[model samples]
Target: MYTDNCYSKIDNISVEYWRVGIYCRLSKEDEGTGQSESINNQREFLKKYVNDAKWTLFKIYIDDGYSGLNFERPGFQDMINDIESGLVNLIIVKDLSRLGRDYIQTGYYLEKYFPEKRVRFIAVNDCIDTFRESAANDFSPIRSVFNDMYAKDISKKVRTAFNIKRAKGQFIGSHAPFGYLKDPDNKNKIIVDEEAARIVKRIFEMYLGGMGLTTIAYTLNEEGVPNPSRYKKTVLNSSYVGRNKTMYWDATTIKWILTNPTYMGSMAQGKSEKLSYKSKKFINIPRENWQIVEGTHEPIVSKQEFETVQKMIERKNNQDFKCRKTPRLFSGFVYCGDCGSYMTYNAKRNHLYLICSTYKRFSKEFCSRHSIQEKTLISIVIEDMVQMIQKYVDVNGIKDKTVGLSFKDGKKKEIQDDIKRCRDRLEELKAMVKSLYTDKVKGIISEEDFLELNKGFTDEKNGINEKLQKLEKKLAELDRKEDEKREIEDIAKKLLEFKTLDRFILEKLIEKIEIYENAEIKIHYKFLNPDK
Candidate 1:
């Protein structure tokens, strides 16, 4: 009876042929482990075992240098595809850990997947074979729990190492920002390339010259200055560069360059961080949490110029009033005398009138209407403008007086010298920091001492930075005054040919008009200076 039963079992095993696939995984984190766990070793062992057992060697799937914490692996998916296509009836791996470290996924495959498909699964190192077992006999669940613990330990170690690097102010990102290149000698350092750096400087200068972000962007495109992403791709040979080829200007790109502190040689990091190891989401941290290392690289823009642009943007953004209506020949030129507010246009009964905008918006109790006939105001402005224009033409001296020179040659030289000196000092400090880092790496200086000295140098560097900022501001002020003089001179020369005032001339010349409570008016003209 025993011999007959054994023969029946052998017949049952021969009913299906086993086509086996080898799975191999090697994580970068596990590089230091024994060679037995290496991908090559796993492949070799699986091949030899399959050949000796007379099983059909179907294929090998490998996920090299990948973490086993998740089952979102490419090779693993390919093996699953083979199973669904009836090409592979059995799966083989060197160990259970190679399959995956996620316990839930491992258990799902072992308990449910293999049985439903009549697929055999085997882990050689763990001595677990699914083909000879009932559902209750499988020990994969216990093995998966251990694999998960291994993954958790690896994650903790990685986090600790990252914290240490961050504290040292080393650049740990895979890619640097636009206009900077990672130093070849030191991966943690960044150096500016002159060609790209010049482009960055031009962008900043255009922004400070009163150009709107969109307008500046359009000008850049027209001038054929390569956009940031395209420039990076050309220089770095990166395949991941932005491929948008429409060549249209975008305001967001201009705004990003204007706001980035990196252009000032400061490093700002930790803007966003991962929520957890399991979650792929990131959350932004507060600015206070940012790790900033100043004077870490070469600067393309001065701190003062950056600050000036920021202040200009803030002023415009927070303005309380909106002046949408275009000024007529004398609409904005007139103001109310009593309330000291702008004289706004009011049309009634086929006649135009000027009234105090502030008084009308608030209430009669606040101020008087300060009304005046628009025709009278227009007639008066036309007479004054014509007289001014004629005077400019007659004497040939209005250009010089109206376009007054404000910058002294000696002051400009002094400001330039001050800026040069500060920059020289900054470069010297950077060289010293680099030397100190070399010493620390060679064990000539202890880590603690290096940090202390670095902090001291940083403080001194910041002080010099403040001085440099003051000098740059003085330079910008001088430049603005010079531009104003030139603009007024040009406008005076143009106005000499005009016979009478028109809407186009009025729009170009006047900014606004304020009216007071007594019907007196004041005109504020557009500053001729581009810097203004």
Candidate 2:
């Protein structure tokens, strides 16, 4: 019901001709819409009150299944707009709680918005009317506070109930997953939907039969097989379901189905958590922390088939990593000496070759090809590794066809000092940028000045950051050399090793193989001679 503008006194302005609006809201979740007089009863009572006062009935605003905790309700927003536009001079609700359960917004409307607009407010059931003086007005604010607290308490109770259901291996999500339906007898439990389960099986079968994920999705879409979203919306007719613009099988959806343990009769809960009672944001919880209950229901797929499919998926991923256009086992371990860029590994169907990345991009204009056969490079590195061990790691070892690692003219201290200075300068620049932003917000500087000065500082900081990065790379190279030397020394002392080259040995001993024009190669080992 609306307020009694006729009964309230406001600077001798009579309520006889005042325009009145009645608002009623019912959230089916929290408030049972069918219970008591409810919305219909509230509307009828409001119409009668306006008639009794002989006031003009502007309109009746009703928001069904909407939360009063927020003022974003369409009906409520329309009422507020009308009030501001002078279309309605007085507002009324069934009670203060009916208007809203948020104390801050409710109090603001009662104390500030309504008064400023010269509009009278009334809550009939609460017996507080601005038109007529009563002690209820004094308690209205306190009552609204209680309403907010009630909403929070109710929210907590509902969450507790949901958690209890979830812990019992029950499916508490708004909609059951694609291949299953909520059990009719016990809504918390799930029962497989045979029709949807068939589709799920087909998807997995196609994937395990060597079909790509995207290809399987395309085939399903071509066949007009309803995706998870479509099945929920059209077949199941779930009220909470939202249809996607294009209801077709997608790779991401297919992948989720394949990965889900639910199809194997496993129950999972606590995959996500809301920020707090008032916040609507939800963050994903790690899988390790998820509550699981095995053999919760009849599985759509066998665990054995599911595990085999997982292995197939892993093999496919590894193959992709190995044959990615020009993938190489020595990837990240080959570089162009001239341009200082890693060489690209290319498989020419018959032979493997390495080409400078810079040369490939711009031909000889940037840098020479620095190309070399994979076999030739391997032979050169093996020879160098043996020589390195005999000269440095094993000074008194038996003779080997190799050169020794030399360590002279090392500038460890100077490089370390430069790195420390760059870091300190970078920190200072970050602090200055932060202070500049604060000054701009405080209006101590104009926007134009702030933009120009901030850009200058950022550019200077970026330049210093680049120098720091180069220094770090240099330091890492030095550290890698020391580590390689120690490892090789230990190996050589054990078995006079460093003869054959395996993938593991190559990765551990060599940092990168630099190729130059005219088939020249440079072996940059973990323990590279500093003077070289």
Candidate 3:
């Protein structure tokens, strides 16, 4: 009976059919620290074992400077593809830890994936072989747990060290801010770059001279000055991409530089932190939570000048500068009918009128200047409102007007369905982009094909996002109009008692007032008009 069972087991041990794929990984922490764990050393050792066993060496895969915590490495993914294609029947690594550091995934691959795929796996240093039954194979799970613990410990220690460095007011960032550079003598300190510092000073001077942010950006771009992003790549030789196709100066970039305290000799650190050690996502830290150390670097602008500029920026943003104390009644409601630009509020010489902002700011060639007096607009709006109130009073006869203010269900449902489809497509596109990047990294797809597909995906994504924004804005406007309509209808019920108009009631009744040529006026009410 024993001889018969031995013959049956011998028939299944097919060693000659083994096609081996040797895998090796060397992270930054492991490189040059251990000679035995080096890529070349791991390759030679695994090859010797395969030769001794008389197995065919099909290919060797290496993931140099890649962490074992994630299985997204290009070389590792290539080996998995070969196994699925039936090209590789066996895989060998230096040790169990070489496969991965994450215990859950490493265990899943070794215990389930390899077995289900009918492929053999081995770790020479750990004496693990799936084809042969051994005590070492049973202990692999415990080993994986230890490896995971080691990675966590290392991550904690590195974070603690960085925190200590930041507390000392040291400049630990890879690149200095726009107007500064890392000191040659001490990398932890920063000094002003004279060439860039001159540009920084010019920006401050322009702002103080009553030049708007957009005008300053346009002047710098017209002068052929490289933006901060282009300067870093071409001049500073950093790997960070500006992500700007044209690399032109813009108001957003100017505002960032203007607001940064670094120019005033303060070193701000820990502005953002990663979600976790395993994930690459980062969340920005609030300004109050940021670690700020004053006088940690050379000053590019005086403290007094910086404080004055900050105060001016605050005052301009408050909306009080345009009207001197409070916003006008029709300040935000008027627009130009021809060019569709917001109308500027003019109160010059006791004359109140709204004119096309585009014509006032830019050349007349871009747009036409059409003006309508505020008094005339109010008169027109109040007269139309009174007519509507008379119609409602004739029909309803002073009854409650706030009971039924909701719009028809058909319109709301159509908009809601469109929003749902757009949101679903956005999620699908995000997943597709991630998969496309992985395929490109694994060499399954060519670079040219990837770029073409990526561009198409990006265009579709941008269009979907813009559509969603518009749809959401439209829905919000509809809801706000319904509520305002109810409020105005209540006031309209009392329109016969008080035949007067105020800013509050006018604003609640009208969404926009458009000024056209030949002194023509068009009013867009928040609520629907039965007369129209």
Candidate 4:
């Protein structure tokens, strides 16, 4: 009878060995609470508990810096996986909140899931053990609801802090936009990156030269120029340099560049906002609703260029032509002399005629139907462009005129010398500012006096700098004009190659062909009198 009692006790002891999975989670908010709230601390506590009870330790699952609001914690998922595979017969956590703060999800997993799988769930701090729960355990549901409310409160506080920073124009992002970067000293301040800024200027130049957006994108791709997104990736990762991926060009991307007011030295914000506190959805506000602050930053595109392009786009959209099936050489270029509307093309008796587009809107007598034959118009335009090109090629004539103008304008040399002196002084001031720290450290000046003196110097320097910059810009404009004259001369030298007019040549050279009443036409070519 004593041997039978020993065998029964052995069976009872074997049944008490529980295969336990320990889970731990630490949120960002709870990081500085104490070491006791840490993942390691939770693991140590559960290990002691399991060891003291002589339970079998299956695994220790941990998720660090994760939110308690969701049960999607990595550690919790791993524990669930062990349970599903029959590796764990029981789950243990430091507290009920460690499992999840979400009331519905927490209740479902505890009551339904654990029961169905025959797994014992226990929260050591909560003193809740499923194996020994009584009718008083009804209060567990209320505790879960309180935990969910705490999560909601934490989420609201985080969102409010983010909005305050955004309103202050602080860059709450990892990366800045193209052509600019966050200032190292102050993350809120945006600073120009000269190398990237040069590329941006080139893009604008190419666009102004009549290249389509797609063509410009293709050219940049061919030259191995990185797109904005790809450039950002490389800048952020030095080890991943030269690993560029091709970006597909689309109308929306091009439109983004055209519409961005940042290029105009303005800050545009609040273009999009969240729909609600609970929803992650965002809705884009209209442009009129966007908060724009002018002169907030340095501009990439000039105000004049931006405005001019806007007008050109509007004009192009308003113009209509009847020769849609066949491309008219001057479809967008021609304007009716009477109505100032775009002229439409008509083919009758194998003769193409350009007529007033406004004839349909009003009586013929209201506006004389300005009409010109296509053949005659083309002949006139071609002859006029060739003569103009020939005139541009007369280098001796140009030299004589330039010499005559120089003699007439004696004050030009003196003005240029004064501008040069101002520019040199501005450069010296900039160099001085950059090296000011060394002077201070060497005891050349006291810190207080140095700062005061530097402020006055900076004020005076800025005044001179602005004037110097204006003068330099004027000089650049003159230089560009000279370059254009030279380009015209080069084009003129190749005029002999075009013995007859063709669509390709005409489109490349001409800007417009204006047909007036009495069948009179005027040609406006690209290089004709570029100096004017």
Candidate 5:
């Protein structure tokens, strides 16, 4: 303590009056059944110390239920603002951890920020006062490092506990999935909500019953079926805020609900992981890494229905289609046969046609204008499809559009072989790396040799891993093709459904149409070899 800007007291007095800001912080980890580190207790101790020292108590700043890893607390910011404004010259806390648990920031405040502003700091319990001689002042930084480590260790233990709960099939999410509710008796258990579950079941049924995502979404919206987000917001009366205000049914939302395993009585955890204990950012984890506990709750839809819907969604996926804008029949499906380029929509006078992209860009220098009228192409498609319904296999439209054909019967086998080879190579690499480590341990190879060989193996393994990822993606495409192939007979039966071509029906059937210069159109059917 000082009076008149000097350390010595006036008239044999050892204490002086100074404005003090009492700060108290309570983290979630510190919510033990004790008043020792509670906000009120910290305030009481700091206020008593300030009062005993005859200092003026300016304000008490309390940040409750905030982590100490960051200085983003509302109370902490207010205290700093006051300090900056010269409202308080001295700061007092029950302990250093109350100041902060991050050693770097704590060290900055203790060593740089506080001193630079000519503010005296005190930790009452630790007997740390920057005024008089004490060994505690020298030990402050070390104590801060220990506090930081404590916070880190506590974070790890909490995460470990959560992982244990997940392993036990406990529901650890703050909110249950949309169609389910957390059990009133047990927070870890979930039970189906009949009201929301009906909506989930309806979405799945509509998707599997040959309805396109947009049609299903629009139908739900038209019927005033509360979408999942809205259902969560209004039905549950949730206090939690969400990203969307107007929760109309969207194709993406319907698709997510259809694909979610939670509706099928499966507990899905570890889909996303936080960046770190100190950060709120999160990233999606791969499916293989996800922890899924099957039959954990009452299913809203049958497993067979769920699996069928998954296959249907994959077959109807837009990767093989394009935009869903109505009245635009051949947006992404029309191409130029001569130049092997996509066709662009264009208008010349009153006529609408699909023109070669090459000719459209280079003015016939690259390729001739392989133009075909949209009306003509549609008539031919309807006639061919009608004919196919009678017999089942007339693919005359595969002639000109063979350029974009991505699959053949043998192509699937080749992709399967590539996948098998990648898996075998991965297993071989694992064994090789294991043997290299064994060789080092057995003294068969020197440390230098082991390091060099290990590095080489790791580099090769990483390269193989990248190839494996691409190969797996290709395998998924092949699987989708197989699914598409089996549904050809089913598709032929729906020829009448295409009589009035809507956007969804159109996207479900046609793959592409290639136009030639001679007014010929080659139409490709999805998931079918025309020659078959």
Candidate 6:
């Protein structure tokens, strides 16, 4: 009950315009079955069908070793291009599953896209013709769903097999890790590559010998020793293209090599997995979730040596963390009103004072030291806090009619500029650290000198970071001035019980305190003009 004249009657187009394109697909799971689903079988069957239909054969598009779960195949895209260009008006496939197994996409193309594009589609084995009205055409969606289920089943089986192999300590990756090679007798097994293993052992030794990661990388690069990726391509004769442009080692590469447990004779697998059967993206599994089988291969570094290196790295990181400068009472809340720079704390024989950082660090031509006594600043801040609490109690709000009560546009711009300057300085500090490592490696600076200079830089970096955080918070409050009444009232209520200013209370109540050369202070409250 199939009619060949369905498309001709519907579009009023003649058979001379019917240029047929035959599409054949053979998935990896379908290969070596020696069945009718072979690539050649599908191609020949579809070709004969097109010839018998008295249609002009435009071209044969074939996608071999492709998954039916996805439609990113090269040949499929090429056929679509011809269809859009009006070179092929009809498409013939051996079966529906050959076109695609994704049920949603298959349904879209069959029921909507093909009809809108004015292209006729035919599946020879499935007895499907988009232009024809038949029971088989109506049942296409159900058949597509079944095909999708089959694909999902196949994917699950493949993943289960891979996991089984991983549990058995088999190597399943396409290429071995940098320090090993796949066993010649068994591809699932690995053996140490002495050439690369020697380099791996030397990296551990260099770290234990007090050479930093950057220094080790620089020393290896200076010796013209090829990095892991370069060694794989040139020495091991591999076709790996990953990180191919990196001809020299870096601190990141050195760290990964040091932290990885593979060099200690453990076979680590299942470190990552595909997001889903239909997605090409992979998500990394946590370290504890990875399947690790120890003593699976020869270890380049002994377990004891590896454990020692890990502890050393941890201790170094802890030292750096502990050395960061702790926040002082008015550390980030004070600034120089004259130079618009943060004021640095100076304790001169128990008499604490804040001086303009710009004048203290650089030439005095840049700025004057707007010094103010710490005790005077504290008294001014406490008075302002009491005034704020009284205002809130007087009118049940903090809004005042004073001209300077609200944050001006000029103050907002200054905060934005400070953020930009801090970000730029951070970048410069990064470059300086890199240069410091290079200097240490080249003997341009002694170990003692490097440590001394690095400590100073670290302190300055930490202080700038604290100042940036306070500036950003002030800017955010200025932008979101509305809907902050309740929060401001709560803080004012707490200030009523405090007579002296502490670090936490000062930070919560005041945004910034600008000091001038005459010991004058201007307090910018966090909830200035709260009712507005």
Top of the candidates by TM-score: 3
Models 1 onward score TM values of 0.54, 0.55, 0.59, 0.48, 0.57, 0.58
- Candidate achieving higher lDDT, 2 or 6: 6
lDDT by residue for model 6 (107-223), tens: 888887787777889888889988877788989999999999988888898899889988988889888888899999999998999999999999999999998876687678768
Please give the TM-score that candidate 4 achieves against the real structure: 0.48
Candidate 3 runs further than 4 Å off? 1-16, 31-33, 180-195, 210-215, 221-224, 233-239, 242-251, 293-299, 302-532
lDDT of 5 at 379: 79
lDDT score, candidate 3, position 222: 65
Backbone clashes, each candidate? 18, 6, 0, 0, 0, 0
Cα lDDT, all candidates: 0.73, 0.77, 0.80, 0.68, 0.77, 0.82
Clash count for candidate 5 is 0
- TM-score computed on alpha carbons, candidate 6: 0.58
Error of 4 at 239 (Å): 13
lDDT of 3: 0.80
lDDT of 1 by residue, 275-393 (tens): 86656688988877887777777888888887887788777655413332434556545656665666677665856788776555433545667877777766666665555545433
**Candidate 1: what lDDT?**
0.73
Residue-level lDDT tens digits of model 3 in 75-120: 9999999999999988999998899988999999988899888777
Task: Please identify model 2 stretches exceeding 4 Å from their true place.
Answer: 1-8, 11-15, 32-37, 131-135, 182-189, 233-246, 307-532
* Superior by TM-score: candidate 2 or candidate 3: 3
lDDT of 5 by residue, 357-427 (tens): 76654344457777777787777878876654554444542222222333565877887788788789889
- Better model by lDDT, 2 or 4? 2
Candidate 4 residue lDDT tens string, 61-148: 8989887766667778888888899999889999888888888888998778887887777888887776654432456778788978
